[model samples]
Target: MTASQPTPASAATLDAQDPLRHFRERFHLPPGPDGQPSVYLCGNSLGLLPKAARAAVEQEFAAWERLGVEGHFHEPSMWMHYHETLAAATARLVGARPLEVVVMNNLTTNLHLLLISFYRPTVTRYKVLMEGGAFPSDQYALESQVRLHGLAPEEAIVELVPRPGEHTLRTEDIEAKIRELGASLATIILGGVNYYTGQAFDMAAITKAGHAVGATVGFDLAHAAGNLELHLHDWDVDFACWCTYKYLNSGPGGTSGVYVHERFANRPDLPRLAGWWGHDPSERFQMKKGFRPMPGAAGWQLSNAQIFPMAIHRAALALVDEAGGMAALRRKSEQLTGYLEALLRGLNLPATMLEIITPADPAARGCQLSVLVHRNGRALFEHLAQQGIIADWREPNVIRLAPVPLYNSFQDVQRAGAAIENWVAQAE
Candidate 1:
């Protein structure tokens, strides 16, 4: 059956029937200069603030004032066990066991830490395989890691790029490359979703292929953790990390999360750069000479949790759990994004003017749609901004629009589409 054309009335009907419609009220949308709520479609960059985040942080402040240092062991919320508060929800979001996940340092720091253990290199099998255009920080991290081990990145890092005339990598091509580099490949790490193209890779298949060749596999889930329905445990991913600022709805520069497969949780031989907080909690206060790592993902921690960021994390995660987890969010996301895509297609802009770089298949993408604006791209972006449409732009030409299922409404998508069509018409 042919899909109906997306219209304002149709969008309103969808919003009215949305089971998660009430969730829009849960976020504090950014306002324009006129004090009106702007059309926010950049959740893929930074999520809207949860209404409860301020209160949650203030609660921690009150506890700190009332108990001082004693807050570490006081009732209500103890600072000592703060990381534990968000573990279950975080685990649920990423599809992992509670023991496999932990909230800790920022994203790249955790990646370096994980690479220390998982990116084990030897004389014969030391090369790392990754996407060619991985987020710059990852490219830097992997290159520096190889150099840290006295290996030249040009010789040790194999980057996989899309085929000619392609915007994203093909899974079969990725697996084929893994097979080709079988013996020399020591590790495989990729973004769970490509930040620039918004393509969600086949992580499970990739992991299976990497394992077949004796390579440890991991993912940088900066865009996928909350946007995609991930199964890090089921996918048998060796290690993974993500920052909570984006789709996780934890504020800007929020606490990051790490996951280590259960298979390596108790491996005493696994080398890690640890600190006092990662020592066995029972003897953590003993000031012992030996550094016996704690079991599970917690063992990788280097310090105590950041309570303020975590308090915000707790509040944001509660909303995810309340909305019935990733399953419910994914359902709404598909429809809302599908509607937006249809609207963009209806614009019928010529290839020379604009093109959607993100994959057309819903299974291969999340909430983001990256539009490549060919003529006067930045000026067109500015035009949208002047219309109170808060979107993100990449250098060169890409305009990224993300319709967040948790807070963004169908009307917002409609407005964004109409605004884009109108802008293009005026520019011409």
Candidate 2:
């Protein structure tokens, strides 16, 4: 082995010295076909369940059985204000003030709502800019939004494509595109992390560029919220949204989170599809005819709190806080992903057989490393599954492995590396 290549012993040593190693016990790792614990590396798609999640859900169930409608006003997590409980923790996760963030509707729903206000396209500036090959939902949302304005998508939607022979978009190219769109750009929204390529965009730079062009800026942080260190308020991001089922470990089809900068908190002039829940709580029970929005992100809510999912989400966020928040988690994540990258590089497989498509710079990505398998990709994925390695397979040819810092250990990375090496050996 080369001096740079990590060995099984080195992996074990790293795990032994890891400060966050104990967090692995907090999650219930999925069992492999062989019935042993699988090296679960699919957190980028769906995170593993936190052991505390069951009790959290049960608490809500008990509240319903005992309290009925009274539960909305009762102590110990009142359903009426349950969403408020998550505000501070959610804010910390994304680097925003508590008032700037709110736990709300699912990701796309929130995106559409935020668009109702932010994507106010006028005759002179009707264009929206996004990355090429964004997650399909984002593509559809932007296309539909353009149509809603009676504009042809082909003319109003500008997608930033990577240069020929490149697998990812460059920051310089993105900034230049913003400049090229200039006065015509009314809104700019991109994934905080590209779901397929696992590339974390330069959000701060993108936000600044968008504002310079007099455009509103936002992000779909579905792949980035718990995976990266964000500063939404400081970055002057106009708005953003993310789902909880991925790295947040809030169960399937969990609720989403939204961020609206404090500057818009009192802007009743902003267009939104108002609902009873968003009406000023001071007068909410008045059965009022006039709509008065609550200040800050909470005003964006269109429905009552999703109690059960919020319970699970509440438990999950506690674990993140106990694990020392994103700054500490990111320190471990960089090391863990760097180790995985080094191991893959050590394989020395031919480009025709395998290639790592995720960015090499750790700053440009989160925990996800998307492997582009050029030959028998599905077969390789199945091989890993049989070997007790759980990873995600994207259509056409990519396999995404995310070693989440909250629960994954260094040994898991070693096992994934060994499994890939075994596949190459068997293929030869």
Global lDDT of model 1 = 0.93
- Global lDDT for candidate 2? 0.93
Model 2 ranges off by over 4 Å:
1-5
Please give the lDDT score at residue 278 for candidate 1: 88
Per-residue lDDT for 1-428 in model 2, tens only? 11224888888888888888998998999899889899999999999999999999999999899999999999776999999999999999999999899998899999999998999999999999999899999999989988998999999999889999889999999999999989999999999999999999999999999999999999999999999999999999999999999999998999999999999999898999898898899999999698889999999998899998999999999999998999999999998999999999999988888999999999999999999999999999999999999999999999999999998988899999999999999999
Tens-digit lDDT track of model 1 for 307-406: 9999999999999999999999998998888989999999988888999999999999999999998899898889889888999999889999999999
* Cα error, candidate 1, residue 94 (Å): 0.4
Displacement of the residue 178 alpha carbon in candidate 2, Å: 0.3
